[model samples]
Target: MAVTKPFDTILIANRGEIACRVIRSARALGFFTVTVYSEADAGAPHTLQADRAICIGPAEAKQSYLSIEAILNAARATGAQSRGLAVHPGYGFLSENEAFAQACADAGLVFIGPPASAIAAMGNKAAAKRRMIEAKVPCVPGYQGPSTDSGQSDAVLLHEAEKIGLPVMVKAAAGGGGRGMRLVRQHAELLPAIQSARSEAENAFGSPELILEKAVVDGRHVEIQVFADTHGNVIHLSERDCSVQRRHQKVIEEAPSPAVNADLRAKMGAAAVAAARAIGYVGAGTVEFLLDGNGHDFYFLEMNTRLQVEHPVTELITGLDLVALQIRVAAGDRLPLSQDDVQLSGHAIEVRLYAEAPHKGFLPQSGDLVLWRPPTGEGLRVDHGLHESGQVISPFYDPMIAKIIAHGATREEARRRLVVALERCVALGIETNRGFLVDLLRHDDFAAGRATTRFIPQHFETPAAPVADDTLLNIAALLWFERAAAACGHDPAASWSSTGRLGSPVLLQYGETKTKRLVAPSGGNRYRVQDQEIAILRRDGCRLRLQVDGQGRDIVFAFASDTLHLALGVRDFACRDITYQPPAEAEGAAERELRAPMNGKIVAVLAAEGERVSKGQRLVIMEAMKMQHEMVARVDAVVEKLPVKVGDQVATRQLLAALNPAAE
Candidate 1:
């Protein structure tokens, strides 16, 4: 519906990135906007963006963003129009809460999305799957019927090792975004996983009920975006390839899967349409599916009954304002457009830039962001909630920093632009997944469109493997020394640059103690370090950039390691410190070696030297934060030794198992 005007005023009951986006859109539409925030978010972007901003409650989500009473009160206090909310629930808190939707209805206002019934229906995974089945939509095999967190009620779960066979996954009835789920491959591990999953489900969502579905081997996760209006009209916009993921969460998404032909797209699109019509669904929602690699069969996973994070790509393809469409539908306006009215034109891709590290084990990072520079220019759309000096990177909420999306005439162009866009995108003062995203886009399989949900952890390796290149550290050190020497007023051309001025002590800080190094510029764009001369290049900063021949040409830098990484571009390079710590030359003995998998702790050790173990048997349990993960043997072997134990600290490459196939 192309309206010549916007709504009078919009009440927003959400927080963070999506909320800020809604306010921007509403303002552009000539509407007044009211924003609500918690006490902790008094200075947040969304709060600052509103014509009228109100503080709802304290910092804790239960009393603040998630409190229905407080949100409604904020709405009433600031709103004077029809009392409707542009209501961008924004991915978390009250977005999917059905009771909140019903409350919005009882208070005489418009809910900008699906009805309360649809929210309640789609809220429950098992119920949603059953509804899809009734709607004639395809579904995954296994028991997804009326199952709750009854814990051990289904013979299908325990026998899952026998039924769908090994490596079956158990999911919560209300699980979304990867919580309340477990992967069990053995009988001994089933009950504990179920208990832990149930406990988490009950704690996080107040419902321990769960559903079980057969794990699709090498499943390519793809979802279709569909928009429906109150006029009983529905349309499928396009599809997003969300196969690059970790822990069941998507990191990268691309529109129009390279593997999906027009014929396959039609089948998936029809299924998505059937799903929306089944619930009499209205507004915009995404229907997720697990597509087989063979491009033959696909099944309905779940329908996200709200605007998705990756909606920008769909907008790029069809050139529709899904948010505006949602507002129009909520305002009692007819859809105006039918199924044929919607069209998919071009290719688009979205990357979720998070404040985490990829090579550092995708560890969640929290700190003040000294800098925030989003990539811009042609085909780039940035949706973010941070500023040059914002301070909301706490452990309280999701670590998503921004969403960078690019659109182009074709999928190849989109991918190419995506790579370049990330290179220019920058976020400092916190660990970020920018490097990981760049690595993924350049990965062999991803470039050729060989994607599945397992692509990330499978290809990148969790607890990132240590890199074999030592030249990067040497380069970084050289840059550090170069900057220090330059700042101390030393001619870089002199071999005795740091020998001290006229017999005084020359103190320079490297780590803690003041150290001096003999420095000399050897020829053009080159440096002589001790006995070796290395090539140095001019990076984007005042710091001396060095390129060593012994080291590889991969790690890129723009700033120093300090309170803030003052860089101008995205940290889009996979960096791993895989240096070999060999034994002393005289000892003639060595430790088997160890490496961390991701940034985590060693929770338990289940093996010892000469301990015979079968393939796929548990060898070690590494714990990160509050979750525990077990390391299993890839092949039948004897444990030659164990270097780690319970409560031991470890990084991704830390050794926990040593297999001797000959001993086995």
Candidate 2:
């Protein structure tokens, strides 16, 4: 292999977990690494681990990591070797930005992924689809051009809707993560979805152009892994099943899709390589498809010009370090192996651990991680973006804090081991989607390897089931009680009469009920929590290192009475004095009040002081987490007074309105 350029320092122009992953890989390859971060990400895990970290700009992404000049300046300031300043863009930010790719090349730094030309071609689905069609890639029926084009005019769309049958998908020509996509089951649903998709496209990607395609029924998502070098060598690394999704984003992914046998795998792999060669793709890329039953037929979805979030699963099976290969490939080395070199090991599955409440429609949530712990054991690998105590799961960026991937000799074994790993993984403060993921993994269909794109909506209709005993919630609380008892200077074995003056009972709220639990230290790693005898093996400040399953495990708990706090995995729960009674006691305590969830300005209010409204009607829409949450009517009522206007500042649980309910 001939070298195009040679150097030794690599700069990662991104933040979060992926940045950290790159730094580790780069260091292992004998390269000094530089990291760039935003104000909010100054203390991020990746920055802390890098050899040299630079602050680019404010917390907002636009001024920081997305600032091409700022990143280039960091590279130049560090005196990095010209070609050694290769960028391993984790996934987001300038990972797929064609301009950024060109800028890196123009500045004499190697962009580790595909070339700028390849990025531009696959960056927009409409353009990518056209190329796929020309390359003889399996494609769904759709018009790959602007919606306003001659063949896709407004009248033509209506006519095409009739021609393609009822169900169709209106999507942004340049969209990712299911954004700018709408499903129209009939003619009436077409126009509104079209308008919404276009608006979302404009808002998300700065393009209002939309492309329409026929929707596939009972589709299973399967994607192929590809690696190409400057020398024109490309190879596919099998397929990954990513059918489990929410909001059109992958939830769980596994390689060697159960839906794809060797025959179909070969077919899909060949097609992916054909598409990549068509675009002259270099470095790591993915070709996504929607597979129908029997797996013989599939439709090309889109191509991601960088490493995917689920790349770990592929690595686990292939025993290949993808990042190293990416670097060597960028160094102008041909792929060390061919498709024949690829072999299936056992099985692998990955779950995205997010700071979201599954009970709350999987809505993004946040709070400080009182305790953060990643599961570690045989056949288990955890790639985390957060650490204990210092990590605050913010509403900014994606909610996923880490991804846990487990491997086994069998699919069932892999599935079972994943459940065990998830059970042991604990995140306190801010709710996590652990409970839902646990249920989904254990669900019958998932166990049977019979999952589809609509698996979440169809199979898991009731997603609010909390972990019964699998989690150490009770153990953590018990540990907290023991600590709180000691904190208040009370010992149960010494007798309550000895002290007489005791601490107040612990009051907390998981949802709407004010539950009280009395805590008394029983001495010797033991406590009485609501008459339940709980023995604590150990406690480390806020972290309670307890004996979970006779195994030394760490848990975090807060015992402050005024602010009730507990963390069940990654989700945060507040213990407030919100009391609920049998209607009689609740009737008289009405004070017209509106409250905020987190710190944010009120955006809009739908009702006036004297307006009447039905139950569940929108009262106000507050913007936070980059999304709007509607505070609606709990019961039919007449508006008494809205103290705060649309632009008022409010705190969590602050009363924003006074409501007088109409007589039932």
Candidate 3:
């Protein structure tokens, strides 16, 4: 067999799912892949899948995955003399870093992306907007120039926001991913948004520079997938509608947008191609646009200089492997297809499955994935980086666990298939947005293809905590009775004595209510759950089969660390096992302690010891999973003790600070 390209070995400078994704394509193309990981990810799934794995730095991204020097060194150390080497910056870390790209070229290695000059030209949001406007692409009317000086007053930004109108957007000039981006709906909110945006931008991209744009209200976020080669050939692979979003970040993405007709597609596609040509792009890139839902009007949002997270949807619709295209282009080969050769087939939709609690403001969750069983069937695809059961979802990176994609002959079919797929995708240990995704799919507006950037926030309401239904209570009682019997050194299967008497009673607590259930012997493998009779059909460890009122039901249930965990349908419920003695409460000031809600690094401390703070005042800022969360004061009190400092990594429920009553 002959090698088709120059590079026979590729180093993946990333971690998790994207790293494994790149490794799969690289290996299939006859390239031995090398993976770089942080110390914490030494035993991760991605590392084990690669031909060679290297440790770059510590757990923090700055010292590890994002370190240009560390990645380059690893690539050099893993290079084979007989084969050429290349580096693929999957998507997040250094994928868009121009310095890293240039360093690859300087070290005589092929960077599997666009030229450094192109990344430099488009990496900055402000500069990219200018280039797009110069290319005659319709752009949103706002400030695209320097909005602030380093560490200086943001008055200039506030003034520009006022000029752009009340509702303005502040975004990081250097990066994307919704970090350092905010939407201000009023004049009074402009300054706070700017300050917070600056802090986040600095932490994410190592720069505080920003750009402002008029927030597009009720706009459909449609993006065109464009590819260019060194031979001056550029073409668009059609579009994906990423309008269904929360926190200005896309949640669901699909190809062949319902609102994009042939004419509109042609127009948007042309603009995307032009944008790619303007930058002399040589690889896969995405040109994002904000389409006015009321009409055919569209404006250029920005261009992502690398392959997007939602590229799977585009691949399903077009029947193309985008990573393979990138590899070929990086090898100086011309694109295999021209504009006319490109075609769109069936509809495809992709939903990002994040390890976060939707009911808890979608805050990033970190814990072990006890049970991960993603759905699989016709036209159903799941791209994930998790290894197996007990794989921990860490706080050092993005919280997206997997991408669930479905393809069908029509948009409605794809939507329906995606809904069913989500229902069957059972992920148990930590919280996830699985049920919330199903809810969004079933919403009338989403089903009717009326979802926009504001759809989740405007149309969908955060579901309240669910109450345990009758079935759930019955299952809980059965498990509780079994646990009690085990504790008493009695055989759970033996429900009666030789004289044939009924079994003992069992007490269990569900939330705040404690109920006593009596299990009586009813022939073989049948027990009573309170007043209802449940026949045990089968039992497989935590998973069980029971006949309730003559109807059969299957469920997965477990008890871990004294917590009762159960998964029913698309929802997961965990209740504290209060069967033990109740613990004593903290006293005085300790009772008024503030604790970390999630595992994160402290980024800011807004309150000082001895400082009198009002209720609801911002007290601390923590960065977790690439987003900043503010912990505020719950009551008007004097800050008595501050335990943690900036840049300290704290675990979930770790005490952060304490407060005492303030003098009247």
Sort by TM-score, best first: what order?
A: 3, 2, 1
Lowest-scoring 10 consecutive residues by lDDT in candidate 1? 585-594
Clashing pairs in 3: none
For lDDT, candidate 1 versus 3, the one ahead is 3
Candidate 1 lDDT over 245-329, as tens digits, reads 8888888888888778888888999999999989888888999999976778999999999999888888888888877777777
The number of clashing residue pairs in model 2 is 16
> Which of the two, 1 or 3, has more TM-score?
3
- Model 2: which ten-residue window has the lowest total lDDT? 495-504
The lDDT per prediction is: 0.71, 0.77, 0.83
Predicted candidate 3 versus true structure: per-residue lDDT over 1-664, tens digit per residue:
1113377889999888888889888888888889988987879999999999999999998899989999888977885534789999989888988899999888878889888898998888888898889999999999876545632358777777878996889888877778899989977888989899989999877888888888888889999999988788999999999999887788999999989999999999999999988888889999999998674989998888888999999999999999988988888888999999988899999999998988777878875677787889989999998875767777898889999999999989999899989877778777888888888889999889888888888866575665677677667767776776788997776775557647556555544465555666565777766678888899887678888889897777766555567787787866543444443322232346787756778999988999998888888898877778888887889888898899898876678888876555
lDDT of predicted model 1: 0.71
Candidate 3 has a TM-score of 0.86
- Candidate 2 C-alpha lDDT tens digits along 1-664: 3235776777888878888888878889888888988876768888889898888887556788778988888888887753466777778888999999999888888888888999999998988999899999999997676545575566666676677776898888885888998878877888878778878999999988777788887899999999988887888999999999987888999987988888899999999999999988899999999897655789999999999999999999999989888888887788899889999898999999987777677777654555677888999999877876547565456778799999999899889889988878777655678777888999999999999998997977557645434233344345444445476796534433345423235543454444555655555665555545556666566655554435565555664433445544434455443332434434433333445565445789888988988877888887656677788777778888777778664545567777777433
